[model samples]
Target: KGISADVINIHTIKPLDAEAIIKSVKKTGCVVTAEEHNFLGGLGESVARTLAENNPAPQEFVATQDTFGESGTPEQLFEKYGLNSEAILKAAEKVIKRK
Candidate 1:
C-alpha cells in the first residue's frame, strides 16, 4: 500500500477530462477508475476508451457491476457493489501489477 497515485475528480462524463486522464496515466503508467455508477457505460468506460485510443495503460475499474440494486444501508450497499475504499485499493493493486 505504499504506492503513489494521482487522483482526478471529473465533474462530468460528457466533458470527461481526457487530457487529465492521459496526463495522469502518462505519469503513473496505470489507472483505476472508481465510480458509483454502472461499470458498463460510466466514467470507467469513457476513461478506457480514451486510454485505448491515446495512451493505453493497465487499468482497473471499481464500480458496480451490471447488477440490480438491493435494499440495504449505504455501507452494506457499497460493500456489496465493490464501491468502497478497500475495493479501490484492490483495484489499484491489481492495475499496478499489470504495469
Candidate 2:
C-alpha cells in the first residue's frame, strides 16, 4: 500500500519515447501499460519491445483483449475491457512480484 509510481503518457506511437520508458523502468524495476486499444500492436507491444532491446524487466499490460468492442456506455466498455484502476492495480502487483 506504500508503493511509489511514475506515470508516463506516450501521445504518439510512431516515435515512442523509449528513452523515457527505459529510464522510468530502470528506477521502478517494472512497468504496466494501459491503453484503450488491443495489446497486440498497441502501447504494450511498444513498451515490451523497448524494454526487450534495452533494460529488460517484467511488464504487464492492461489493454483490451483481441476482440471487437460492443456498443455500450463508456464505463461499461472500460470495465469490460479491463481498462480501469482495478486492472492497473492488479497488473502492478503482478509485475512487482516478477521484479
Candidate 3:
C-alpha cells in the first residue's frame, strides 16, 4: 500500500522484535501496535516500553484493556470495547499528535 512503505509482523511475545520495532520507530517517529490481548501485558505495552527506553517515540495501543469479554459475538465484543478500525485510527491520530 502507498500509505505505508513497509510492514513487519512478529510472532513471539517474550522476546519481542525490539530492534526491528526501534528501527521502524526511528524511521516513522510514531507507531500503532495492535493485538488481541489485554493492553496491560500485550505486545503494545512491550513496544511502548521499548520505545520509551530506546528513543521515546509516540505509540498508540490497540488492544483490550484490563477487562474481560462477555459471551457474545466477536463483532459485538469489538463494538462494545471500541476495538474496531475506526477506534484504532482515532488512537493513531491522537498518538501522532502527541508525538
Candidate 4:
C-alpha cells in the first residue's frame, strides 16, 4: 500500500488531456481510471486508447459495469457500483502489481 499515484482530473471528456495522461503513465508505469459512468465508452476507454497509442501500460478501471441503474442515495449507489475511494485504491493496487 506504499504506492504513489498521479491523479489527473479530466474535466472535459471530448478534449481529453492525452498528453497529461501519457506523462503520468510514463512516470507511474500504470494507470487506474475511476469514473461514475459506464465502463464501456467512457473515460476508461479514452485513457486506454491514449495509453495504447502513446505508452502501453497496465491499467485498471473503477467504473460501473454496464447494467441497469437503481435508485438510491449517492453514497449507496457509489458503494454498490464500485465508484468509491476503496474501489479506486484496490484498482490502483492491482494495476501497480501488473507493473
Candidate 4 runs further than 4 Å off? none
- What local distance difference test score does each model get? 0.93, 0.93, 0.79, 0.93
| Model 1 C-alpha lDDT per residue in residues 1-99, reported as the tens digit of each score | 698999999889998899999999999999999988989999999999999999989999999999987999989999899899989999999999999
Compose the digit string of candidate 3's lDDT tens values, residues 36-86: 678897888788888889989777888888897677888888887778877
lDDT of 2 by residue, 2-98 (tens): 6789999899887999989999999999999999999899989999999999999999999999998799998999999999999999999999999
Query: Each model's RMSD to truth, in Å?
Result: 0.9, 0.7, 2.4, 0.7
Query: Could you tell me which 10 consecutive residues in candidate 2 have the lowest summed lDDT?
Result: 1-10
lDDT at residue 66 of model 1 (Cα atoms): 94
Cα lDDT tens digits for candidate 4, 1-99: 687888899988889999999999999999999998999999999999999999999999999899889999999999999899999999988888899
Model 3 local distance difference test score: 0.79
lDDT of 4 at 98: 93
**lDDT for 44 (candidate 4):** 96
Report how far residue 40 has shifted in candidate 2, in Å.
0.6
Query: Model 1 misses residue 55 by how many Å?
Result: 0.3
